[model samples]
Target: MHIVFVFRYHIFFYTRCSIPFFTNDTFETQGRRHEVFVNKTIPMVVEGDDMSAYSQCEIYKTSLNTSYSALNMPPSNTSTEQCNKWVYDSSVLKDTFITQANLVCKRVIARANANMIYFSGKMTGALVLGLLSDRFGRKKVLIISTLMHVGGAFGSAFATDYIFFVAMRFIIGVSCTGMYSSSFVLGMELVIPSKRVAASYMLDMAWCVGLYILCFLAFVTRSWDMILLVMASLTVLLFVCLWIIPESPRWLKSKGRFIEANAVILKWETINGKKALTDTSSSKNTKDDIEPESVLKMCTIPNLLIRTLLIYLNWFVIIMVNFGISLNVGNMDGDLFVNFAIISSMEMLAYTFCFLLLNKTGRKRLLVGTLFFCGGACILSVFVMLFFDKSLYWITLVLSYIGKFGITASHSIIYVWSAELFPTKVRNSGIGTSSVVGFAGSMTSPYISDLGKYVHGSFGEVLPQVIFGACSVIAGMTSLLLPETNGKALPETVFDAVQFGKKKADDRNSRLNCFYTNDAFNKDELTGEV
Candidate 1:
């Protein structure tokens, strides 16, 4: 059930980012004409420059008879006027909101603004829905979010007005955050600690599958509205499946609903063909009187503050770099669909590798390694693009994929690592807060990617890549301060989280003391023997 929900949610959530690429069309000034009757004072041989023939934003008032000494010369006695109409090339894209609403030239910023608006909605949902899930139950929020998601998707599909479409996208973004965060927390809580790494990998694989499905859907439909309608229709099945899924037992226990928690566990055991313990004694051991901690406690507590800040930074960097690279698919020199599909496949491989190494290498070490690897790839790709010839463009693509692989692995690890770091009492809230910060990273990525277009020459091409790579490196170094969470039980309370790393620190100190003592004794024994 969790797998189905994740798979469908990703399809709905990620498709928005890819829509702009299909909808974007090359356009030229409308009603452009040359006056043939104007007198030419001088005659010269001319060569036509097709590239400079037409303006995208402005129309030039000039005569075809204007005198020019050479080809590619600016039209003499010409005045510029802002074009009110445009003729979009519909050869590639049959129809799009950009063409329909005329979002070209000066209005092009609206496209990036729309993406930012959606991410802002995601930020809001992370905070509000995350808190709601912790205060209410994950199941209730998940159900509500599913309905919201479907409604928003349908709204987006049928929207005629550009503003209306943007609004629907925002709603979809908000609902997607709610659905993902609630479902992820619920899924994590349902499983035992030992199996969490595997479960996380499974969820990530589901996401990859959704990406593949999206690529196919986009290819088949070729229309953004049709694609949305199909995906929304398919997502309805997840809502139906949610009816049979149970709430998190861990959440029930955290809220002091031991009877409910035990009931859920007993059902699981019965389904697995094991004898269920009828004893209520285990419930009595827990302190039902203890109140669940709020996310604010993480900020106030000295022990948790640094950890929380560090995790937030990691979340920000991972999301920024990941989305930054993913959104650049359209700008890459190749088939857009093929590039997206290849990147999705790379993500699947990364998840597989991460699953295999997670336990052996531990979370912190693996995360740091992947981040550093991604950063190195991103930085190297820039140099390749700048210094190397165009013939080596394929090498740049390979390096970009390498960066994708590293970030994909890091993305998988962070989800499991952050979940284990936060206590059950405020786990949803903690993740939600981190997600809020992460969404900000995503919000900025579209503009960062647009930097390539605003800047000229090779430097413009590699500027975004350089920024992403630098951030990844900085994040990797900062992550070194985070404690390893592999093989550790999920922290259950604020107190438990506060003490999470203390035992390891103590053990290390003890080992050092023993080593020094043994050395001193060996030195005395050697002196006596002499």
Candidate 2:
């Protein structure tokens, strides 16, 4: 009797949920409905016995010998207003900025412009906050950035118009850059040189986890306003957590606050279960004895200038290709949610793979290889799309996934590489400059992805793919000029950066031995006098 009751309940539930409602009389009516333009006005065609209003309208139009037009119709000045309506697939996003702003079809450009504006703000923020972090302190800058982000997120959720929403996104973008740059540099400073890769991996892991969590939240909440509010609250909560963390010891020492630096180091030593260094004077001597140089010197020196330029260029290309692929995933012909989930899952796997190979393969080899791999896959996906039938869509999807994996892994490597490439004094400056320049790529990436629509009449959808792939390939070859800093100590001064990769084998070995023997003193050495 219990089994019979459970079976009946299951049957009833399925029958109730599976019942279909037909807006069009025939199931195949979906394929026949079309969008037509009459006198520069576009409207959706509604047909079938189920649509009585549309059928009546058709009879009225035929009786008057006039065409059916959704737009440019006579205005109804009564108590109610009537306008043409569109049916949008609600599974992908319950409500997006575009949907809320009423930016459909002809007004789609506005949505793209909003995305571009946010990245432009990121460029401005990188320039401003980079210098602030160096001069003020990483922790302070991080806290300020977080507060700004929280404020921007809240502002965005309550935005009254499309322009207001765009402006808020720009504000959020600015704060995000500050938080990103400061937190990364600070995390690197807190760990040993050998363990920096592990530290970077942890940060990447957190980002990937957040991405998946966001997807789940969007699915559950299904409201753009609610989503933004939740994100803002979380960032505010993280700001409170930031108070428990200390300022970077290296940054403190750089500012000549030796006592505070030693206190922070001692706290770290206690946490690590290691003995605190008795000689704090050695750290003071290291800083006071060495003559500090100006940040401008990085540009004056030829080797430093060339290295900085190369790094900046590489960063720009990597980010361009990365975001290009990420944003375009929606345009691909598939279930939007499934494609996004697949891409996000692949990124997580890429981070894990990168962590495993980073120490062994070294930075340069991995960077060069991944760029080429990404570029090649992008180009190949286009080729498959053009030459093959629609039946082979899975092949194109697989190639795109491979490309995303390579780009994601490269992102992880570049952060650690850029931080190591610059000296302590100007490290933030270098990162900020590279990030600012890289923002150009991000700013243009939306338009690049949209190239398909503009040029699809002349060239096929392959033009955007060609541009994305070519940039990746070119950047990969150019990356060969970069100096390898895989297992080496982070440069502490402009002179240290100038001397990077120029040392003899014996000198390198000697530094490595000393680095291992006294890890605490080595920390002082890595930061260069500070």
Query: Could you say which candidate leads in TM-score?
Result: 1
Model 1 TM-score, all chains together: 0.82
- Model 1 lDDT per residue over 1-530, tens place: 11111111122110011111223322321222211111121112222222222345554444566444344334554565565665554433445566556666687777767767778888988999999999899999999889988888888779889799889888888888899889888888776555677888888888888888877877776666677778788878886779788998777766767688778868877787765443333434345224767988878876589999999999999999998777766657776678878988889999999999998899999999999999999999988988898798899899989999999898888888898898787889998999999988877877787686699777988999899999999999998988887865556777667667666334354322121111101212112210
> Candidate 2's error at 226, in angstroms?
1.5
Residue by residue across 1-530, what tens digits does model 2's lDDT show? 00111111111010000001223322112332321211112222343223412211111122233443365332222122222233333445555555456554456467667667877778978889988888888999899888888888899878869888888888888898998899899988877777788999898888877777666766677666777877777777776669777998766666666688788878877787776543445443454223454556788878778888888888898888887777766556666557667888888998898899988998899988998999899899887978899799889889989999988888888888999888776778678888998888877776777676577442547777788788888888887888898877666667666667765434454433221112222635433222
Query: Residue 93 lDDT in model 2?
Result: 53
Clashing residue pairs in candidate 2 are none
CA lDDT, every model vs. true structure: 0.72, 0.68
Worst 10 residues of 2 by lDDT: 10-19
Runs of candidate 2 with Cα error greater than 4 angstroms are 1-87, 276-296, 456-459, 504-530
Q: Residue 400 error for model 1, in Å?
A: 0.9
Q: What TM-score do all the candidates reach, one by one?
A: 0.82, 0.80
